[model samples]
Target: MVGALAVLAVVLILWQILPGALNVPRYVIPPLSEVLVALTDPVAFPRYVQNAAATMTEVGLGLLIGVVLGLALAITLTQLPRVYGIVFPYIVAIESIPKVAIAPLFVIWFGFGLPSKVVVVVLLAFFPVLVNTIHGLRNVDRDLINLFRVNGASRMQIQVRLMIPAAMPQIFSGLELAVANAMIGAIVAEFVGAQQGLGVLILQAQGRMETPAVFALLIILSALGIFLNLFVRLARKWIITWERT
Candidate 1:
């Protein structure tokens, strides 16, 4: 995979350079050399890291909140039949609303700060977790549940010993997706209104028509995405420690 990436990098470098070396208009595209040239400078690089950190901080907090609330809601909806009848529809309705459409309201209400970005991230990230967790819990192996009952386990014991453990993998599956969504949502929230962050830097670069800087921000953001994915994969692997069996 590393070799493949290196090959692709070489190809892209060649692809980007071939045109500009022949004097392709700058308006058409900047060369890979130009992109690399810009990348060499340290001044523009740290801002990308700072902004990425800001966005990641918001995403981490929001994903944590979203996962907790989603799990709580999913368990409630599954365990109590009566609660589902009253609450599930509301959950659907709230989840159906466009997060971006209401993100400005979050900013207006929570102010243009981390709180608002975190709120947006949670709103966008929770649905996947909620739906997946509910599905996982409600679709437990009937035999295992029955075995627990036959053993005279109470509801809490059934939940703790059987249901939650069984559902954990699926829950983490949703959580992985939610983490990515949370990051995207945080960046988008910042793009709409933020004083610092990659999204803000992108907006600034866009306003200035700084193509190399824009590309630089994009590269850094992509790296952040890769790291987030790797971390989540590691977390999921740890959470499902029984999967090896």
Candidate 2:
């Protein structure tokens, strides 16, 4: 925490000094003080809070749906090798398509509302979890499986007692990736079409040439992404304590 604070302080000092030192225009890069003022402005702060809440709601819901679906599909594939062989290629094909290209299709299907944003988040977040879970499960120690078989352990028992626990670290790694993707997906959906969200606020600020407000919004978004990533790291430590042991 102290290290993070020190880095933040240095960045803030640089942000406050660089533009003026370089004789840059305020319209291009507002000073940190101007951005802080925009961030704390009474008229704008409340709206920012509301839009942040909306974006977070979409991110949370989409993360839940995507992670659940990905885990389920991964487990199914692992349990059925024939199905895995048949479906893996198609999964690769689907993932090859750029999510930005598909965002419009979701907007047309779900409209300019929370649903569309959630769908985009799901699409972006799902692949990481699916890929990681499959990799982890497939790479489980064969000796462990043989030992379980020697004990006459059922397939379900082997999975629950050994495989899942061993795969948790990789799954958590996927979760970290999902966290960033979820935020990006929400913002992209908002950019495509939305009445409220940080993305929309950014567009509005840019249209009005509110450079300070734009910088303020970017700061808020960066802070949010950092917070979410830190939360995931904490959760990973809790869930995989054996790693530290």
Candidate 3:
């Protein structure tokens, strides 16, 4: 924590002084103080908060859908190797396409509303969770599987009592990746077009040459990402406490 504080202090000092020290134009990189002022302005701050909340809603909804679908598909594939062989190649092909390219299609299909952004988030967040889940389930010890079989454990029992518990660490890792991807997906979808979101605010600020406000929005986004990442880490620690022992 001390190290983090020290780094943050250095970054703030640099942010405060660098633009003026380097004679950088305000249009390019506004001073940190100006951005801070903009961020704290009662009117501006509330707008920022509203837009951020909108984006976060999309992210959260998308992540929940993505995680549930990914876990369900992963389990199905693991249980049915023939189905896995048939489906995995298609999944790889689809994932190979840049998701941003598909965002426009979603916008067209869902309109310029929350649904489009949520869909984009789902697309972005799904792959990591699916891939990690498959890896975790497939990597279980053969000896453990045989032992369970010899002890007359059913396949469902093995899955519930052995595979899922063993896969928690990897699943949590995937969830961490999904959280970050979900944020990106939300912002990117908003960029394509949105009624209200941080991305829209950013575009409006850029158009009006409100460089400091734009910087302030970016700072808020970064802080949000950091907070979410830390939350996921704490949740993982709590959920998989057995790993420590």
Most accurate candidate by TM-score: 3
- What would the TM-score be for candidate 1 when compared with the true structure? 0.90
User: What digit string (tens of lDDT, one per residue) describes model 3 on residues 21-68?
Assistant: 999999999888999998898989989999999999999999999999
Error of 3 at 206 (Å): 0.7
Residue 112 in candidate 2 has what lDDT? 95
Over the stretch 64-88, how does candidate 1's per-residue lDDT look in tens digits?
A: 8988888888887899999888988
Q: In angstroms, give how far residue 146 of model 3 lies from its true place.
A: 1.3
lDDT of 3: 0.92
RMSD of each: 2.3, 1.5, 1.3
In terms of lDDT, which candidate is stronger, 1 or 3?
3
Evaluate model 1: give its lDDT: 0.83
lDDT of each: 0.83, 0.93, 0.92
Candidate 2 vs. true structure, TM-score:
0.95
Q: What are the per-model numbers of colliding residue pairs?
A: 0, 0, 0
Considering every candidate listed, which one attains the maximal lDDT?
A: 2
- Output the worst ten-in-a-row residue range by lDDT, candidate 2: 95-104
Residue 73 Cα positional deviation in candidate 3, in Å, after optimal superposition: 0.2
